[model samples]
Target: MRDVLRIEDLVLKFRGYTGVTEVLHGISLNIRAGERVALVGESGSGKSVTARIVLGQLQELRSAQVQGGLYFEEQDLNRLSRRQWHALRGTHMSMIFQDPTSSLNPVFTIGVQFTEVLRRRDPKLSKEAAAKRAGELLNSVSIHDHARVLNAYPFQLSGGMNQRVAIAMALANHPSLLIADEPGTALDVTVQAQTLHLMHDLVERTGTAVLFISHNLGVVREFADRIYVIYRGRIVEQGPTQAVFENPRHAYTRALMAAVPRITGGGVPEIQDMDGAFFDPLEVHGEDRP
Candidate 1:
């Protein structure tokens, strides 16, 4: 499988009045064609930031300092102009955000919003054609009543329903890459699982590579072929999901695995603080030294 996305020595920092805060520390990873890759960690682990960089969203911030290569199909994403990214974002690569409400406009009917998205790639597409295509995309995501969904406002739908609609819109054009950033975090566990499964099925059918970012190890384990464990902005472990889970090499990876609760066992065990022991640069392979 050829690599569709690659990041080498990626670093991100933000400048503030106090000083510069480094968020991502020389992160390196890749996603092969039609492969499912997961970036997992606790909240504030820079997973979201990495996703944003991949989607070319961080280029807008003047205070942000980004270094290293971000390649999509051997094209340097960091070098693309904003206009170029605008052209590529929806048609060639799309993103599903954590909050559906934030992604969907509340004032417009879903039909109107979806139509606009369709016309973004094809300016001459008629309203009727766009609606028909939108309905088909919605149906692909298992929303049977596409008519009701298209006519309804985002606020009128439940969180899960809105999320499904979001997924439909993101996959509407069959983008080669899908950047899903904590997409199921807002929904309940059952709904989240269902939504993730639906995404997996759709991606499999379309052969779209997925870059999934989440804090939930359980979801990552279930959805991703390969898992990258990141802590404090640096990747600590990367390999096949089963290998990392069965034989974790990093202390942080072991801690994260141990944190997952067992269904048929005693209460959740307290994770011992190793006095910042796992954060040592010497213990991890992907860390950049000063």
Candidate 2:
């Protein structure tokens, strides 16, 4: 299968009053058509920055300096103009944010917001048609009462309900690629599992390639076809999901895997620094940050 998304040595830097801060050193990964890939890392591991770069959101920041190749469907995303980014964002690729309630517009009803999403692929679609399509999309996410859910505002629904709505909207246009940034992270374990199941089934049936960014190993094990372990903005290891799970080569990957609680009831393992570099807590002057 052809690759839907490819990142080659992606490096991102932000210019500040102090100096330049480069976040991503040189990270590369790809998602083939209909393949589910996960970028696994802890917070500030440059995962979200990579996602924003793929979406071209960071390009809007005047202080942000981006280097290296980011390709979508074999097209050079780095060369895309702002107008081009706008054109490609929703129609060719879509994203589910970390928080459904916050990512959604509290001001607008779900119907209106969902209509906006659906209209991306069909500019001439009528409100009635959009509503019908939205109902169908909601149904796919297992929200049967589409009428009520559509009319309800984002704040009006529970976290799980809003997450379902978010998933429905992200997949509304049936884009070739989906970037799910830890969707349903705020929901309870059972609800998150159900939502993940729904998302997995939807993508599988729709044949949409997914770039799932998450730090949850258990979730990645269940959802991703492949896994990429990232540490401090660098991709240390990547392979088929099962292979990586069975034998993690990188120290960070091993630490992450070992940190997961097991049914055998051994407490969490001691997670050591991947590089074993000691950071003096008392030292106010630290090394260069990512």
Candidate 3:
């Protein structure tokens, strides 16, 4: 399969008053065209940092330093100029952040935001055309009564509805790569499932590759074709979702799988200590096991 996005020996650091703290430690990953990949890890595991790096949004952090190669459609993002980065974002690659409320403007109505997104993509488009497109986009995400939704402010809508609108805006340009960072975190079970299914369907239909970042293994199992388990900013295990979930080779992967909530009869297992030597699947030289 052709790779749509590639990260080779990626490292991210934040310079503080004391010293530079590395968040992502030489992480490497590749997302094939039309593939749905999950980046699963606990909070502060550098999952969001990795996504931000790929979206070219990390440059805003004054203290942040990014190293290593980040390639999107064969273009090295780390070396991209400001103009190139701006051009690439929202056109070839788009991201849906964890919180829709924070991402969307509270002052603007949903219609205004959606129409602005459309106009930004194509400045030549007339307001009527943009409005029509916006309505269609909302409907695509299963949001009925487009007119009402368009007029509603971000605060007027439920979390799930706002998330769907966010998704619509992200997909407004029909981007080739979609980086979703914990999209369903604020939604209820049914709504979360629906949103996930809609996202998966839309991506598949559009032939857009997805890099879905989430801690929910069950959701990942259902939505992702492949999985990359990150622990402390490093990929410990990566393979077909089923293979990795059913037969996790790395200790961290096993621990993550064991941590997932099961049915009523199935009780939570005791989590093991994660103090062992970190394993890197990409490394050829084996280190002593902890």
Per-prediction TM-score? 0.91, 0.92, 0.91
Q: Name the lDDT of candidate 3.
A: 0.85
Local accuracy of candidate 2 as per-residue lDDT tens digits, 1-290: 79999999888899999999989999999999999999998778888899999999998999999899988999998788999999887888999998899999999999999889888889999999999999999999999998999999999999999999999998888899999999878999999999999999999999999999998889999999999988788998999999999988776787677655578964444444557753221121222222
lDDT of 1 by residue, 162-205 (tens): 99999999988889899999998899999998899999999999
Model 1 stretches with alpha carbons more than 4 Å out:
264-290
Task: Please give the lDDT score at residue 148 for candidate 2.
Answer: 96
The whole-model lDDT of each prediction reads: 0.87, 0.88, 0.85
Clash number for each model: 0, 0, 0
Best prediction by lDDT: 2
lDDT value, residue 257 of candidate 3: 67
Q: Judged by TM-score relative to the true structure, which candidate is superior, 1 or 2?
A: 2
